[model samples]
Target chain A: MMWLFLVTDALLFAGFLGGYAFCRLASDKPWPDRTQVFDLTFITLMTFALITSSTTMASAVLAARNGRLQAARGFLLVTALIGLGFLGMQAVEWSHFIHAGARMDSNPWGVPGFSSYFFLITGFHGTHVLIGVVVLLLTTLRSLQRSNADELVEVVGLYWHFVDLVWVFVFGCYYLV
Target chain B: MSSQSGVSSYRTYWIGWLVLLILTVGMVFSGAKPVLVGGMLAKASIITLLYMHLMHERRRLVWTILLGIFLTSAVLVVLSVPDGMAM
Candidate 1:
């Protein structure tokens, strides 16, 4: 049951990536220099922040499984805080791009590939982040209600880890190569 | 017990994920195109394999379904991009 959701979620992302690549390949001109315009310094830090949050979320889930509700809540709160930080960084990146006057309509690098991909792919990912934030909030609420938190932690951890996995691919496809 | 079922029960994070992170950044600064491409493949494989690994351990039915789905997607990718893509 829990596992099914993750696979479905991954497939959804697969569709987004496929559509992104189709547009990129289907275009006539050269592909954009992803690394040059990406501002790796910002995304690198964002990756680190999100990865740290996953580690913390793992620990929180472990604590919950071991029957430590208070500790679980503490770690979950930290995970949420870190998630918020990543979201803030994402907002900053978008703001910088906006201020630089990049949009779906125009490609500054003269390659619509980058411009189109930048909006669609990251926009899909940002939506996932928002959903993740909401799930974490609900998990926190469940922490207060559940007498046994293991099942809740396990479910949330599955989603949290999936989010991390998604970013791992995104980081590769968008930033590195 | 056979060697393969035994293999499926064991679990660990690949150390390469940590190494790949540093390698990616280094490749960025080194001006080596091959390193960047190779590093990207290595890193993407790690994420894909790790996700598949976890899913296999958690739910066998979904594992089978996802495997079929992934394989089909791979075919589509090979037919499509400069390759079918992550879709």
Candidate 2:
């Protein structure tokens, strides 16, 4: 059921990307240069944090499955911390963009869709990260009290990894392309 | 997928992480659209297969998930891009 949900969620993102393509390709005005607007160094750091958290989550799952409850809980705690850090970095990015006069309807960039889609796509993904962090913390707390089900750890790991997967495309299409 | 001991499992995840990082760096350096798209796909595959353990699933389930999303997404992109360019 979890896998099925992920597939559907992924399809939803696929639609978003498709629409992003339409808006970008169809626009007469040039899309804003991402390099001018974004701090690539910070974005790269965000990516590193996410990917590392994913590895931690995976390790947590393995440790849980192997009956190392304490180790699993430790890994989960680290993953949650990293996830929170990623969200903090995203907040900084959003703050920088807003201070530069970007908004839902308009931005300093000539192409309105650029900022619109930027916020829409990244905002949606950021919300997922936030939710994942909350879930990880809750799970860690539960496991700290007593060992939780192994499947539960695996399922949460799946969601965390899926979030990372979506960011790969967002980073590629929005920032790199 | 064969059962990996705890050490090897952690090692596998880190290896996957390394590959993803390398791909990300390459994409950052290569601004070409094709290279970016290709790198993005590769990273997604690695996350799905290795980190998510999709490779451990039965063949039928794997095909269903991959094809369902991949084909539909491809169609959406293929149709959207050209029509958009023609606009």
Candidate 3:
């Protein structure tokens, strides 16, 4: 069921990205150069944070499988913290962009589509990360109780990895090429 | 799927994480270069296959996931071509 949800969610993102590509190519106005408007260093740090959270999530799953409940709880807590850190950075980035006059309807960069797509796509992905963090928190609590959380850890790990996977595409399309 | 014991070891996950980190740095340095897309694809595949344990899953399940991705990509590409051509 999670796989099915992921597959359909991926298709939804594909459609949004495809529409973004169309707008970018069809627009007469020059698209805003990503590097010019966004902080690459900050975004890179966010990427690392997210990937590290995935690592921590994997550790949590492994520890659970090994019946190390305390270790699993620790790892899950770390994962949640890292995810929260990533979202915090995103909030900062969004605020900076907004202060620079970028919005869904208008942008100082002259290409409205760029800001529109940027906010829409990144905002969508960020929301997923936020939800993942909340879910991780709950999973961590369950781990602390020493419940039979091995299966629960695996399911949550799948969702966490999916969030990270989506960010890979988001970073590629929005920040890189 | 096999039991939890069949899951890849922690070392495998660490290696995958390291590779993904390297790819993220590579993409940052590459800027908006076309090669960044390849790096992103590689990173995504590593996380899906190793970290997500899809590689150890049953072959039929793996194939289904791959097919879903492929079909989505094909549909999106086909849909985008006309708009791209119109540009």
Candidate 4:
């Protein structure tokens, strides 16, 4: 079930990104230079935070499989915390852009699509991270009480890793290129 | 099959994490080069194979996922080429 959802979701994101590429290629107007607008250092930290969360989530799954419920819970809690930190950084970046007069339709930059795509794509990805954090929290609680929670952790870990994987593309699209 | 028995060790996870971080830093410094795309692909592959345990999964399941990804990429390429030409 999760695999089905993930593959479909991946296709959805690919479509969005492909549309973005088309718009950029077909438009006569110049695209905004993302490097100048975005803070690479800050986004780099956010990427690190999310990637670390992936590692922690993997650790949690491994620990749960090993029947170390306490360690599993601990790792899940850490993963959730790192995810929250990523969200916090995203909020800061968004607020900075908004404060600088960047909007979905209007911005200092002439290209409206830049802000729109940035918000739409990153916002979509951020929502996934937010949901993953909530699910991680619930799974952490479940791990505390359930004797056989390893499979549950593994399932959730897949979702978390998928989210991380999507961010890899997002980072490349929005930030690097 | 208790999924745990064949699971990777903490050392492996840490090493994968290190490699991912290094690739990320390389991307940041490399800017908009074509190699950065390759770097991102490498990062994604490492995460999918090592961290996600796709490498250890059944060959049929792995191939199915790969086929889906390939189809998606092919669609993106096919769509983008016409758009680029129209430009």
Q: For each candidate, what TM-score against the reference?
A: 0.79, 0.95, 0.95, 0.95
**Candidate 2 runs further than 4 Å off:** A143-148, B1-8
Ranking by lDDT: 2, 4, 3, 1
- Per-residue accuracy of model 4 over A1-177 as CA lDDT, tens digit each: 777888899998898788788777776788777767888999999999988999998898888877788999999999999999999999999999998889998789877777888888999999999999999999887655875688888888989999999999999977888
Location of the lowest summed lDDT over 10 successive residues in candidate 4 chain A = A139-148
TM-score of 4: 0.95
| Tens-digit per-residue lDDT, A1-177, candidate 3 | 777888888888888898888888788877777778888999989999999999989988899888888888899999999999999999999999999998899989888889899899999999999999999998887545646588788888999999999999988887887
Off by over 4 Å in 1: B1-62, B82-87
What's the ranking of the predictions by DockQ, best on top? 3, 4, 2, 1
The ten-residue window of minimal lDDT in model 2 chain B covers B1-10
- What CAPRI class is candidate 4? medium
In angstroms, give how far residue A91 of model 3 lies from its true place. 0.3
Q: Residues B1-87, candidate 4: write the lDDT tens digits.
A: 125436657777888899999999999998857968898799889888877788888778789999989888998989896976599
Worst window of 10 by summed lDDT in candidate 1 chain A? A142-151
Report chain B TM per candidate: 0.42, 0.83, 0.82, 0.85
lDDT of 1 by residue, B1-87 (tens): 011111121123324336546755775676465876576556555544442334335366646755766785796577666543333
Collision pairs in model 3: none
Model 3 docking category: medium
True contacts kept of each: 0.17, 0.78, 0.81, 0.70
Off by over 4 Å in 3: A143-147, B5-8, B32-34
Instruction: Give the clashing pairs for model 1.
Output: A14-B87, B77-B84
Candidate 2 lDDT over A39-115, as tens digits, reads: 89789889989989999999998988888888999999999999999999999999999999998889888888888
